[model samples]
Target: MSKVFDFSGVDDFCSGGFMHTNPKDSNLFFPLGRHVDVYFPRKRSHVSAPFVFSGEVKPQPSIEVLPDECLFEVFRRLSGGQERSVCASVSKRWLMLLSSIHRDEIFPAKGNLDPEEHDNTSISVKEDEAFKPKEKVEFVDSERVKSVNEEFEGIDSDGFLSRCLEGKKATDVRLASIAVGTGSRGGLGKLSIRGSSSTRGLTNLGLRAIGRGCPSLRYLSLWNLSSIGDEGLLEIASGARLLEKLDLCHCPAITDIGLIAMAMNCPNLMSVTIESCTNIGNESLKALGRYCPNLKCITVKNCALIGDQGIVSLFSSAGHVLSKAKFQALDISDVSLAVIGHYGSAMTDLELLDLQNVNDRGFWVMGKGQGLQKLKVLSITACGGVSDSGLEALGGGCPNLKLFGLRKNLLVSDTGIVKLARAAVSLESLQLEECHRITQCGVFHILANCGGKFKALALANCLGIRDINFLFPLTSICHSIRSLIIHNCPGFGDVGLAVLGRMCPKLTQVELSGLQGITDTGLLPLIRSLEAGLNKLNLSGSVNLTDNSVVAITKMHGETLELMNLDGCKYLTDITLSEIAQNCSVLTELDVSKCGITDSGIATLSGAEQLNLQIFSLAGCSFVSDMSLPYLGVLGKTLVGLNIRHCNGISSSSIDLLLEQLWRCDVLY
Candidate 1:
């Protein structure tokens, strides 16, 4: 009975003999104690089997009091993710016990589902499903995830790697457990502590433990950890010699001294991100350029101390191999731009934002220089320095530029677009936003000259494109335009939309979000004109949109559509949902948020045999209540993400009931 006692309110769990479980925290740990060969029930039946007393005070057996062999049996029998979650929620003791169980200890549910479905397979699977599952794709693999052999390729085979602590769970005790546990397990490959926590719970003591134990660590990310300082970082620099990637954000305690130490020690670094760390300056970046030659990607944002001297020095040595770079809110001038243009021979993608001191001459020098011929992508945002002449210079410099994006630039006019199109013959796609000075003449120039290779165009809040037909003739038809996006352009009425229908006939994906002026009359023609058939269509925030446009779209192009969003289309009802369910055969994602959808609408769609959605959103659908929950359960097998936010009519108990029923889906209520 003592073993089965409640392990609650025991604040100093390390000194006392109980687990102080934080219900809200994701990361869990156990205090140092003697081994008792922990175990659990083997079967769900054993867990639920109530004592049937024979009218006597016979002691009942508890899981906590069971033998070690019996405990391991129950843990083994708990195969599915749903069952494991239920077990963890039973009490704090189970959580701490489960923390020590390694990947090899738990066996997968062999006859049945994937890794996600098999709960007892690995701590990797458990952590993935339980903590930050949304960061993963819709049951798809992330490109960042490396194979087992590649993850631990050069390192020794004596470290148990990979631990992530976020929100309230990032603590010193958990860090200590990770540091000590790696000795018995394998080597540490990756570790990350993110977001705000309980009074900056992790400090130098915990980080020092990790540095001493984890020498094979390859990747590390620390964000918003104000308590951890240069001492802890120096320890990591001296101990973790195989570190490859480092990401630091909003970490006020870290400075150039700490980062320089890492750069000098870890020569194998391939990628680095530094954001909002005011204390870090050019010295740290210089160390990276001088020591880390294998680096490929560099991102620096909101670091005011990084001026032209720092950028020039960093790129001078690292520019030969660097391929991707992004700089935002930096105090750099034309000197940095000129230096980058001179040495950036291998650069492919570059983004520049909020460089207040840079002017048109800097861009002109970048284009007029001898480098940047291999550049494929360039995005500039909120830069007053990028004027018409500056764009002309850039277009002339980068001949192979495939994609260009500009946002919130007040200096770009119609002449710049024409000149840029004239100079850059290989231009493929262009995205423009908040350029009020660029009128229909800019669109005319692009379509006229770059029509052969121009395939995609996205315009947002650009006042210059109101009347496309009035500016010029319709002879410049772009047959290759596969994607077109026009968002929040209320001035673009039916006339402009109809003109677009004839101008772009091969569009495969299109978005007309927040275009309140366009109605069924304007949308029906565009839907009918597409020759390649639509793959994705988003008409969200179209308040005037009704069932007429939706029904027609489904009847024509629903068979090939993979994703559709009609969020905030308040006029839509059950009829539209029924039409979609009956026609969209291969549709995998659907969003009708903020619509007038009711319980009957959900039932009609959920009951339909043709529906097979993996992601569904019903946010702000006030008409929906608890009655729609059962109907939604029909898609439990296919759905991985379900959003029920702002649904006022649904009760909390009902939400809990729905979560239990749809154990596989991530319900965001």
Candidate 2:
């Protein structure tokens, strides 16, 4: 018989040992210093300590953990990168739990589903299903997706629309009714139907279904829907009362009646984007002013029918509610410009694109208006009529303007640019593209005025940027310029670039494409000086560059280089690739298309074990073949896109294997 000893004291209890009365048996827990354990009567044996951690037998709570589903709900909220890098590294149990989660669960498959099932797949219909309209075309809305179906090619709008509008003329009406009947139970708030080869034009009937099904819809984006006329838009207005934001892009069928319908039905509509609708006129603007009392933002682009009168009507009616407006590719003249200046007083953001007629007089009128004071972002692109007088007016009128874009405006000269520069000294970003008339004098004036605060400056296709002296003042102006794009500027060579190299030590992106005069003499110093800060470098079409330039780049900017484009650099050889492989480890995108690199060069780079290279382009390399495929397969896990176009040496079978191995990668043949 086993002896039973009963004792209770503070010393025994506090000394990592205790005694408990077991209901099944009179088991006792004793601290023997070395092998403390509980005695079980049924088994007639001693049980080990409940918890043995780090050589200490500590009393532990039972492993009655929460459910896996409960834990998953907490961990799934992490961002994609966080879930993969941080959460998965904790333990095998955690790794398994995360791995068990279906990718579709993490990032739901969006877009229109196929008629056969409700599963989230990009493939909606087979070849036979393209002709059937009686079958319902299922559209499901998901949260922000990273990408859409690119393989849905070869399917045009005619075939897709045939399926959508098939079987019956009243199908759209039925779908709308169904949507409306579902109400808030469907939890539909945002719907984005972007263009796809298989996706057809959506008319009023389709919209009816959306309105009926998604009655609580707050945002709707119908892109490239050419069949959508005012009749369809009216259906949306009537059914979707809660709609606050609507984006109708490239929908030519919509007219002024549709805008009026929206104004009357959606009183809460705060933002509307109507692009490429040539039929919209002043009546729609007047209706919006009268009906949409709370309207705050509007973007009207490529609408030739709506001119100054339509804008005037809109401002006259909804001036108090207006804050942001963009007018692009319009048929507006000086008359419209004056009207905008007079009534657009409440606007904070304004963009004028491709305006053919409005000149300095319009700007002068705006200078005297109330809107100029509140304007913060003013983008004028391809406005040929606006010259020195207009720029001068803007300088004096818009005091708080932080962003100024003057692109494709040949009329803007040195005097105008200087005048504009002096006026907006607080400018943060100045983008001057294809402004051929602006010279070194204008550049100096800009640097002297706004250089202190300027963070981004792009000079593209500017024929007058030849003087090397223009580059000297950049360092004194601001030591840090985040982004600088200099393309098609034939005048500035090695001497000018040396000045830029010293001044732009903080350049993150530098595009020196099409600089015909630049050679190793100019590029090497600049690359070496800005090595640490440069993340993106574009030397495409710089034919004069040799292999030594690549060596300079790898030596200085290996760690920081994420995107490197050496397209059309005929002199770069296998030696360049060898050097890059040995030094650079984090290159995400490397474009060596049309370069004279062969299999030897590519094999070395792909063989590197540390590379996380995602995008690789060897489009015009004729020698790349099956031998290079194995090496590229090393980066299969990280690669997202691979362009092997015109690589005649590669067999179709090898390409198929690559596609199979790298299933997620977008391979271009």
Candidate 3:
């Protein structure tokens, strides 16, 4: 009775499968008859018909999750260097999936793979399976992604192992790693490192890592590295055999030993930029010339140790292969110039700045040489002794020159410019700044001959140019001038600007700052002529710009104008801001400092939902206050730098609130 096993208590005794139910008990048991004739159940039983074999029953369809391969395919789309590292640490599955991805697909062979390539998975498989175990990846605390000098205590114990494992997540770590990984996977075609100098010296350990990581690195740039020495350079040279370009900037620790070793080891090096390295001299140049046969570009700047001997060695060794040479602040004389002229047959671009010892004789040597025939760009600055005759010689020698820049050459006059214009007829850019002796007649002659081909012409602080009537012929002579800068030219007035505005419709940049004589009359016509073509307009200190001028410019060039400087124009008010807010939706930089704009104007500009303003300077605008501060909070997302200095009406509390909201913007009070 307690067990309730009797057939009398069975509800379905006649059926093949019977359910037992005790009258005293609430529970009921059913016998599900099958292969072995065994059955059991409880409570409410729904036993029906004669039981057949219970072993074979169709299962109901159930929901299935995505497979690992499909999940990995989803993750493949997120595989960037930093993205992959961050995702790999999410789980073991993601780590395996990222590791399985082909190295070539991740790093790429040519240029970086397009973002869209990560989405597709049907790429051709590799011919051979030579798999190497992927290095274990860990998430770099984005907060800890700073210089090694910044209290990263345990990083050095592993001897740059953590840095290599962290990969590109840590910027300072990767800066040291760039030397290692550049050519490691196959060939890192380009490597650039601009050091902060705060990290402890990237010692031999880091250097060895670089050598092992980047074997095929073609281009290497190390800047402001305070501690890297000869050993580091040797390691780089040993690993990056195909290095074609090397830029060493402010690396005072590097000496002739390092430079020579690099030149000797990296045979493919074609370009060398060494700046502010005091220890590298003539011997380094000789090594480079003797070892690097393919040398094409040599830029030696702020290097006081390089003398005439070094110049001669560099020219004698690599001059045949050299196509571009830039020497700045060096003490080489006419002898060095002669050496360059004699040996640099393939030279196309030459820049010499502050060459105190170079004079007309040096230019004469270059003018007479057949080696400079292919020279296209010639820039010389502060070479006081170079005169008209030297310029004439230069003009005649390098007839293929397309761009010429001469600045602060006290001896240069109208004669030199006229001679240069006649010889370099294909010149596109002519920059003659602070050349006081260049008269209107000289400019006229230069423009008459080369104006048609001129793409850019800058003449700033030229006191002798009183009349620009010569510009009247610009419509017929030059229609291609894209950049015209005549800043601080007291004689250049409305008439000059009017002529230029009518002639150059494609002007992308027009800097007429400090031309106080220019009023709305000169400004309106120029902005109207340019329409939407102008990208930068500098009318600061013009003092004559008003709401009318702002309205006209914004209406015509709202879409294209990215930078507008109305600083020192005290007459501007809320109307200017309103017009700009309504029309110039894409304006990124607006400098209305020292203007008469008030709180309402600032509010209007900051509230313009469409304006993507990044830099807003309201310096000396006394009327901007707390009322305007709220509108700036709305711009907090896009703003990068804001100057609220001299805005006496704004309260400190409001400024603090604004600062808290715009935490990213550099707020200057």
Candidate 4:
């Protein structure tokens, strides 16, 4: 048993003897002193104590009886430094706690502390005295927090409420506001308050809080935040002087004012993403150029307000430092291209430039500059203004260009293609999709020049391509070509595909979608030749491929195969699918949508461990019923993406089991 003391009404509990509490039990407490008196729980009268020790007996004192130094240590651990200072008014114990907690706050130096003030310190000094002295301590400024917090209304109450509950007991301590103001003295390095959408108009408050608390912040991401504006941004700029990466994507409210403030304040700014900020125009871009001389990468997609002048300003300001620029889906017409060509000549270090939707005149202007020698990937899709002449200029200037996208450029013909093939000797991937005038003659030129290094070739909907003979020379030279896509080429038949398989022995992926003339006869030779590296084969809309082609492919490349797409092949039945499920050991993704697969095919796939399947797409396949759901559950553990959309036969029970079995499944309709 332990003695109990009551001092709840006692205002100050600073000086006292050593307190004691049972080592095993924290609840029983008593004080250690000759004048100590105990009060019974039922009565108010104090009783005298002899304080005699007995067997299996101990004394535990209340918090009021503990020594001031021990009490200060307890309070220091609880309140830290900032809260301890504010709570000091409650009692002497709190004052001691505040002093003890912040004793080592200042940086240590020799001959800094006053000798007269040294005796006033309650903390015992070490005898060795080798420790360096420090100067007087200073409190964190409140004015900086106030200036930044004013822009964010209604956010201060929650912050104050949280602080009030922390230190001492003061019911009347009605905090007016809590601001994390300016100065980079003791600030946070990185401030993140993501996924807090319910706190309306509080994002600015959050930003201000960070600026006040973390002055040395380097990286900040305000993604999907709509409440932040110019005032909050300016506060951050003035406070976080060492900021580097700033991501403000989806922040529609940010305009020229906020962007300019950021550019001017953050000198070490390296990467910035301003996607979907429609209000950002020329003036702000110029500010970015003038302030952030070390800017490297910038993404400003869908910024409709940005025109030729803004782009020119941006390039003129940061062209020398920019290494990557993405301006996708913008209305950058001929004027913008001219501006880029003139001012962008300074961007000699540029590697990737996505100028999608900039017309033919823009391409000509871009080609006129000699700075694009280091350019690698260039995409200029849907630029109706571009003609064959623009491509000729690009080929002549950008000799090191590798991946070139000329999709939807209607004027590109055999002559322009031949010119590009001869000049761009380093070309590895070329996209000529919807270039209706491009013929085999142009492709032959590419084969003769840069075909040996080509990796990916896309010629989708090229109407002039009649035979695969032009590809043979290229495939023969570049045996390393991996991905070959020739969709909607009506002139290509079995002969072309056979030649492709024989020449491109290292091809890993082949997309022959919408080739109506291609039958199993064309696929058989290719499948046999691609027994080594072929992993993905897209034969969608090739209606003529029946059980024979699938059987031959499964028997040949079953072990190494991963994904096989046979969508719209109506003739494929359960017999071929069962054979595939039994033989293909490495098959993970099998897309047989709109095929004539029945319950038998599902049953065949149910027990095969060699399938090791993850993504199973059976959209538009009406033959499968609820019977296949059981088998799906057995194989559901490894499934990641399952698309059974438009499968009318599946019921709610089957879906429930699917949801239970495949914990990581993403079911798409």
lDDT of each: 0.77, 0.68, 0.71, 0.64
Each prediction's total of clashing residue pairs, residues at least 3 apart in sequence or on different chains, is 10, 10, 10, 15
Model 2: residues >4 Å from true position, as ranges?
A: 1-214, 220-235, 248-258, 275-279, 342-346, 467-475
Models 1 onward score TM values of 0.71, 0.68, 0.65, 0.66
Residue 129 displacement in candidate 2 (angstroms): 20
Residue 546 alpha-carbon offset, candidate 2, angstroms: 1.2
Considering summed lDDT, which 10 consecutive residues are worst modelled in model 2?
143-152
Scored against the true structure, residue 202 in model 1 reaches a CA lDDT of 73
For model 1, the run of ten residues with the poorest summed lDDT:
145-154
Candidate 3 lDDT over 1-669, as tens digits, reads 212233332454332333324332212222222323233444444555444443444454422145767755665565334354444444444444544443333444246754423432222124011121233333423333222121111212212212222222324344432432222222345555566466463444455445544555666777776767888788777766778889988888889998998998888888999999877888898899899989989999988888899889988877878999999998889998888878887899999898998889988887877678788999988888789988888888886888999988778999888888777767788898888888766765665566457788888888776656654454444566777777777776776666666667778887888877888887788888873367888888888777888888888888788999999898899999999899897789999998999888877877787899899898989878788877878776898999999888888998888888999999999
Model 4: how large is the Cα RMSD against the reference? 12.6
Give the per-residue lDDT of model 4 (tens digit) for 480-561: 5788888888877887777767766778888889998889888888888873667888889988889999898788777778
lDDT of 1 by residue, 448-514 (tens): 6673788888889987667555555667788878998989877877777777787788999999999
> For model 2, what is the error of residue 457's alpha carbon versus the real structure, in angstroms, after optimal superposition?
1.4
Best by TM-score: 1
The ten-residue window of minimal lDDT in model 3 covers: 123-132
Which parts of model 4 are misplaced by more than 4 Å?
1-206, 216-227, 248-253, 276-278, 302-305, 328-362, 439-445, 460-477, 487-499, 514-517, 529-532, 606-609, 637-646, 654-669
Candidate 2 structure quality by residue, lDDT tens digits, 306-407: 888888888877776688989888888887777666677677788888888787788777765655667778888888888888887887788777788888
Candidate with the larger TM-score of 3 and 4: 4
> Which residue pairs does candidate 3 place in steric collision?
32-39, 180-210, 180-213, 180-214, 182-188, 183-214, 183-215, 183-216, 184-213, 184-214
**The CA-based lDDT of model 3 is what?**
0.71
